[model samples]
Target chain A: EFIRKLWEGLLVQSKPPLTSHFPFPAQIPPDLVDKLERLALVDFRTKQGLECLEKAIRFADQLHVVDTTGIEPMDSVLEDRALYLREDTAVDGGCAEELLKLSRKTVEEYFVVPPGNIPLPKKEERSSMLKHSEL
Target chain B: MLGLTLKEVSLAFREGRISPTELCRKCLNRIKKTQHLNAYITVTDELSLTQAQESERRLQRGVPKGPLDGVPFAVKDNFCTKNVRTTCASRMLKDYVPPFNATVVQKLLDQGAVLMGKTNMDEFAMGAGSTDGAFGPVKNPWSYTEPYRTLAGPEADWVIAGGSSGGSAAAVASLTSYLALGSDTGGSTRNPGALCGVVAFKPTYGLLSRHGLIPLVNSMDVPGILTRSAGDASVVLSVLQGVDVRDSTTVPAPSSHAELPEEFDVRNLCVGIPKEYHALGLSPDTRAQWSRVADLFEAAGARVEQVSLPHTQHSIVCYHVLCHAEVASNMARFDGVEYGHRSSMDSSTEAMYATTRHEGFNDVVRGRVLSGNYFLLKQNYQHYFVKAQKVRRLICDDFRRVFASGVDVLLTPTTLTDAARYGDFTQEDNRTRSAQEDVFTQPANMSGLPAVSVPTALSSRGLPIGLQLMGKALDDHRLLAVAQWMERQVGFPSIGVHDDYRQCSDTSSTVQTSA
Candidate 1:
């Protein structure tokens, strides 16, 4: 719950970041803007806000605040709060997917695609006897 | 000689001087002769012939679609065309074909520009030179000397064309097509145009629609053109510019039929010289040429002043980080899945996807994608991506502040050194080389301001030299008009060496140092 609140607060609707603390701003290198937007959560109040949230997330991740291994069983919301304060991260907008991914079911969805497989075509004996020209 | 601007090509057809069929034939012939320049990845000769026949029928009916109606043109390979292979110059999409045309391609076809073929580019438009492309490097038509063998080998004697729009620039330079479409994230369009002695224009962001374009950086990837002249660029822009529902980024501004101020007066123009552009790395010969050109502008009554773009130093680092992030995202769509080339996924989905990408993409693109992923890993995104974005804002402010302070346009060299040998940019030291190459061009892109690189004169080695003119966002017409006027004043020689291949025999350094 603490991590959730922290994610919420960090991503809460806010103005576009004028500072470099976020992933994207009104002006950044085209490449960097591209980077921030890609990782950025689109759920922010504005496009700019989403970019900011991305930057904040990136900042925390770089500081080793985000545990990539997923080994710890600590509450996600609590983890987020620790990251928010400890990393001093600020995001102009919130990312819905990131928050959702911290939930139980969504984690499975992130790892799965269509599970069914296509069966190989089976040829009938009559069809197999057909010549190339006849076929 | 089919000496026709894209606009003139249509005019000629209307005047009965040439039929669209004949024009297509001529263009086909040129491509056949000059394809050695590696200007194209695929030549849809059959498709082009069919389109030309259809255009002839339309001409007979006296119903013209638009100015570009029946004008032969090519697009950089990154754009999707219904069934044509759109590689983005990487093996990842070597056999991939999109089901739909990019919004820009649709607009062009609707305006009646004939599709000649898809041109080559740096893989995913990532490199300064076209060397990083999967097909092969594009050769400069102007840099040709003798025997016309392509630098790629003895059978293909074309010179190194400037890139990543090297193919587009070379095509237009050699009359392979009337106009060619290119995408500019930085100086891609202008740099090649300058090196190839053509007019390349990157309009203000949102001026030209970017829908369906394979995204480089969403904000910076503006569709641009390489043509023979600024007026022709205007003609092509007229056909391509407008808000489209598909591309949400395009501005709602209607096409501006703004007239070129009848007599261009450089007297009222304020040209800013950023101190950062004149740093120590600039060659003496280049500096001399720059000074001479500046003097020419002054003699023509233009007011020139030195100014500082303080945040200029961070442009390269910021652009690289940002570009990598975008690459990481844009490329995610190419994971051998539903849309693109799929490899046998005997392994897990992620593993299969990784293997496909690893096998399919070239080294340069893969390196950039990995770097982008690393940069955005939760922790790095904040410090690198966010900080880069902030720096980007400062870059934009630098341009805004300069223009607001009475500077109508900013002038700088397009690249510090003329086209280096193709191998110079691929080594580990590429970061330094790339930085020097992008010095004058990145700021304009970072700010979303319009910039044009016009060929001013030849370098000491007979390579072309260009001066960039940057304008306030959306003020593209003025920059082009001024460029057109300057083009008239200092008519630079066309690097027409492909037709006369005896100029490049000697590989002496003096060739680069001579006037």
Candidate 2:
């Protein structure tokens, strides 16, 4: 008899109330999706990208109904313990060659990237531009 | 030998029954034979043999490093290994080799553990199913049928090895390696561990150093251990858990919890069965196994009670928000600057950056990055990111309140069901499937508690089903002790090697070889 009751109790406890699904924004605007693409630095301008974003947003919307008024936002799980600190020291240097070896394009000791649109002021104006920015 | 635990194999090495070189050769042979499983991304044949030879020399001298000495193990490709490619199963890093080893990998190698290979995983460890890698999808060993072995193509129906640590779980399950290192952000390790019939352990956050782990979520990611038994998991954890200057989040002192109690008594244990774990979509077999295990604890003179963690249902939603927000920030490093795949579309720097990311990342990774940036937008930051963090506190408080109420641990199903068919699993988008698959396992990640998935029984369909036990923060040893006890009682049958391959392994004489 106790076993039967235990089984029944197990069955009863297994069924918790389903998470309430509150209605969320039906669709994220395309402009907002474009902005997200720019910020993330990924091309999400396709149909598939928009669909993926919409699904993720809808899934995350479930958290909005949670009431967290008095609770402080948790940044790290180890907030209770003090993080370990060591004396400020320089170590693991002299690996510029090794670091440079990993890059596909390198000029001398520096990584090579495509030229930027910002035209460097003529060599004569470079010092003046720096001075102006500092001022 | 492949069927044995790390301790068992280590004992054999001490007894001089088998040498480390022989065991490594057998593992390499087995890995070769089971290539169809798509478990490994890169096999370090030369490195493994060389390491094995060194271990053999040490064994001959009658001086061993530790329990892991001469044991063969695999690592998930996400952890950087010096001079070896660590792809994280993404094209962005397909040909990229690291200049330094991850602290965890270095620690294991320092103990003389042989590195068999690097296993496959979801690209950048982003998805729930291991089907999203650039190389190919990993098929579950349990679901590999006779006909499919000969007839199956990439599109053929097969069971999924759960991800993002699917390859590690499959490797351990398939007996190709004694143990494998996996990383768990939410349920990446335990989800696959349950499906693959192995012990998957996620230590308390900050308990294990995460240096060079290739962060998925910096705040929640922990180096996970996957082995055939709880005892082996304990042995591996003892070697890897410590403070490292490379990762500042590590706890200051070495964890004494790595040492298991000499004798564990369940009579003194008070196990809490969190009622909220009995959530929707939990299969009948999973629920039955959960209850049976609870009954086993009660029968053994332990107090079993129902506890309510009201914030459990909100964890998945909260995790999505935080995970996406962090991913957006962390993934910003891969802009074709120094390492990783660089695009040749160098018309302009901005064009090059966008093109490189678009070509390098898959749809799922790009989707998360996009949604992550959306959540972090100035206007929506408070609504999504800040709100989720506050809800995260509530989730953490739920575990705290339960533990404070004299509960030694909480027992829940590791996954809602057994391993699913690739055809059926892919029916839903990766994001939807991950949310559903990770429901039970993510809460512990949220709370920063120690959790282990112990395979308890086979479902009616002949697939593995595991139950999860979560202990309070830093209570890893006791938690694993209980899991070890449960493992003994259950005696879950692990996957066996093929008879033909077993015969071949037995007859092959050990050869002294150098790479």
Candidate 3:
């Protein structure tokens, strides 16, 4: 259920780190723990990331000293300058061949990543879920 | 040859008394001689010699590149150099060579500046003691103390060169290079600069391009210049600052602005010394030095007053969260797939990624990445990452409020303490030490303000005590001008080669005896 809640939180929220939508957990679940353990947190050579995680939790409570009421959560921009987007265009500086040289497995124009164990969505289940949502 | 300032070197070259090739050879010899500082990860002997020959040819033609022509300098290894190994002092990029030069490196190259070597730094710029890098601890060139660690190994008491950019500062102070480029992600440049008696400048964010520099914190990381004098910083900053098409976040340079004024009058200036900084457990020597700087400013007809930045206590804690959060995000691309070292190659990609990171990263890097990932998780995102960002704003706002009230600049001590021993620095671990190292310097990065650390006085330990001056964001030229005025007023002594690498007389504490 905790994992489901986390998964749901990720889906519904477009802007992340929303302080509005969380009852933060005391500890990481095993699957997320396992994923973190797989991603950057190794089990053997380095211990599981519980120490850092706990430190983060403890430190997170310190911000409550200030009343953050009516203050919009700050984003990267501090100055109110208008951002002008450049027109969509490709520049010639990119040297694809040189960049490709760094790739471990490349076949002609495409990068060859190792086989990922991602499960494909079942067609019947997808249709049933879509029908239930009345889309 | 190592005694002259960079301008003096340029003058000698202009007067035809010295050739670029000769200067390069002299610098190369000095770098070779100072191998004990561990200042460089890779000294580009052939590359610098080749560049020197080209610069010499230009000089002979009577069309030199610029003021920096033939001036030897070093870039922190984090900056990529095409066909050169650019390690961020990590085993991951130990054997990895780059196919491109960082825009800043290319800029220096354009000026025909001699490239000496790539300096060593904390692994991925994560630590403050400069001890955790793969090359080992960068020794403080000013450490002329007892119980020296040189021959006794860990049992002696020698000082640190300062962190993440320790090699850069040490190289400049030791006369190995005229100037060295160090990335200041919360004091990576200035901390080392303070300890080594060099000028470290963190310019306003987006004022300098971040192209080709390895990302530490995308918002805060900019290539900082380490120089022997405040004026030298201005020269280098002028060359490095501009809009980089590759980096869109750059603040577009003004369409029409005079070249940064190398001189300014000190009269009628309002300088603020933030009161919150004094509460950070300042040492007696540091306190005296801080007061001396304020007195100098006042005597020079500038208004130096104590100002409040109430949110200062939270800045270090705030920086810790922000730095790790970004490190995790930025370093995610280093999975064993493309550029860096690939270890534990296996059929399973997930396993390969985990194993590669574990082996490639040091404990400091891994811990930061893990904590960063934990904070970024959807469930805890607001409670950690967002809260930290909000506090970051409050800190920035504190500066804005202070700057708004007739204050042209703010003054503060660059570091809480003078040079610390390697054994002492490593006691608290990287995470804790980094927070303290960044206490004063992080506010500049946090608020996107321009700050420079100029040497003011020698500490009781015979180390450099740096005084920092911060100005409003986007006013880098003005800040540099003020720093130059202060630099002239203080008249701090320069580091001489005679003082370093001497044997210690007092063997009071061993590594075992230290806390």
Candidate 4:
């Protein structure tokens, strides 16, 4: 009887299905994919990458049925408690040399990177570079 | 001695039955013998020996630090260890070493716990199965076989150690280490703990300091303790839990310590079995064990009641949205500029960032970043990210409402089924597997409640199955007490390297009478 109640609860829901109200795109459009690539600084031209994104979007569509009316968005789990703050003070600093040692390419004290405006490596070239690095 | 629990080993150390150095050597030797498990990313042989010698000297002086003194423990690779390579099982930080130890690691070291080494994990704790790691998948010690030892090729098939703390779980199960630290973000620790047959505890969110833990989802990630017993977990938790200025999220330590009572009075307890947990895809064995345990609670005078957490169905979806959003923001710091893998391409800073991320991260990590960015996009923020956050409130409220109704702790299955083969697990994408496996465990993370997965029974396949007990925020002591009672009642047989080769033909007779 207990198990039956559980099954019944699962089948007979209090809320209506909201799938029609919010029609999520079946596939992530190419332009949006390009935008995501730019925003995340990742290349998602492959089929697998696009599929993962589309699946994620489809999965998230389930939330539309949740009637979150007047619900304040919870940013942290400790929303009920007061977040303590410490007095502003420099606890640890003055280790620029040690910090600089972590980087691969450094010019004196600063990290060295190529100047802006240079184009990205081609797809084939990027793969080859990765392969070479692996070796 | 190698198979003893942390408490037992500590007791042995105090009684002079086993020296810290001898125990450390035994652990190191076991780790070496079980190399095929791929549980460790790096073995701190010299460092561990030196620490063990120091512990021996302290024992000689009768000035041991605490219960954890001289016990060997493993840290997940995601936690920073000064001068030791801290890889999140990613090529990105393959050679990168931190300048300081994680606060949890430092606390354990201060307690005189010998650090065995860093355990392998999912690349950035992103995958449900440990297979996403760059080093290799951590094979379940329960699935070890003679063929696995002889097999030289990578083509050998084996069961998976669930992730992203799969290596820690595997290490504890295999007796390579008595206790290991795993970071749980959306069931990473509990799932592996369930699969690998160990006690995995994820305390309330702010209880343990996450200062040096490589962030997966900052709000949900907590340093997980994986051990052979709940008592061991409590001991480790007592030492590790406290407020840290380094991490503002850390809460002040509770007035009482986290020690578990030898027995709990079930008559005073109300065990809530959330009906929503009886969802589809739950294995027959797991469901039976769930029912059996609920029955046991009732028979033992506890008021085992059927409760409803209506918002449970939407937790996984809500979790994915929030997890990806946080992951996208947290992962932004990994650009090749500071410390980690750098692409040779220096044509432009942007190009370097792009190619470096592409080369450093695996497909699963990149997918999350891209999807996270999409959700965070201005046009989609309100629809996706904000909606998920609102739904997250409902999920948290579900737990709050149930606990408010006088339910001491909620009992649920840690995973839908037992460990799967590597081939079977990889059949689905990382997202799907994670959604299915983490369904029951992630709700606790979403609500910031303390949850512990206790190995309760062996599946018909002879793999261990764990059940989770979740308590209200800051109620870890009672939660652990209940869990320890359940542990004593079950007497679930733990696995060892020697028992791996036994044919699992009969499930009924395989249940051990003693722990």
Model 2, span B1-515: residue lDDT tens: 88999989999999999999999999999999887778999999999999999999999999999888999999999999999999988878988999999999999999999999999888999888788888777777776533233434423455788988999999999899999999999999999999988999999899888999999998899999999988899988888887898888998534555446657789989999877777778899898888888888888888888888989889988999999889989999998879998877665676567767877888788888888998988998999999999999999998899999999988899999988877677778778787888999999999889999999988877778999999988888889999998988887887777622221222111221000
- By the DockQ metric, which is better: model 1 or model 4? 4
Candidate 3 residue-wise lDDT at A122: 38
Model 1 off-target regions past 4 Å? A1-135, B145-159, B258-262, B423-430, B495-498, B501-515
Error of 3 at B491 (Å): 2.2
Q: Lowest-lDDT window of 10 residues in candidate 1 chain B?
A: B506-515
Q: How close is chain B to the truth by TM-score, in each candidate?
A: 0.91, 0.94, 0.94, 0.95
Instruction: State residue B29's C-alpha deviation in candidate 3, in Å.
Output: 0.9
| Regions of candidate 3 where Cα sits further than 4 Å from its true position | A1-32, A39-49, A83-87, A107-110, A118-135, B144-156, B254-263, B500-515
Q: Of the pair 1 and 2, which is ahead by TM-score? A: 2
| Model 1 residue B15 lDDT score | 84
Rank list by TM-score: 4, 2, 3, 1
> Model 3 lDDT vs. the true structure?
0.76
Candidate 4 per-residue lDDT, tens place, B1-515, comes to: 78888889999999999999999999898888887778899999999999999999999899999998999999999999999999999989999989999999999999999999999888999888788888877878877544333442333456789989999999999898989999998999999999988999999999999999999998799999999999888888899998999999999878766567765799999999887787667888898888888877878888877789988888888999999999999889988998999988776887788878988888888889988998899988999999999999999999989999999999999998988877678788888888888989999999999999999988777678999999999998778888889998998987655654433332322121100
Stronger candidate by lDDT (2 vs 4): 4
On lDDT, the leading prediction is 4
Q: List, in the given order, the native-contact fraction of each candidate.
A: 0.00, 0.73, 0.27, 0.62
Candidate 4 Cα deviation (angstroms), residue B423? 1.2
Q: Write the per-residue lDDT of candidate 3 for residues A1-135, one digit (tens) a residue.
A: 332342244234323121312256556565675566555434323233465565555565556666666565666653567543465787765687887787666799676655678322233432232233210
Clashing pairs in 2: none
Q: Tell me which of candidates 2 and 3 scores higher on lDDT.
A: 2
Q: Give the C-alpha miss distance for residue B421 in model 1, angstroms.
A: 2.2
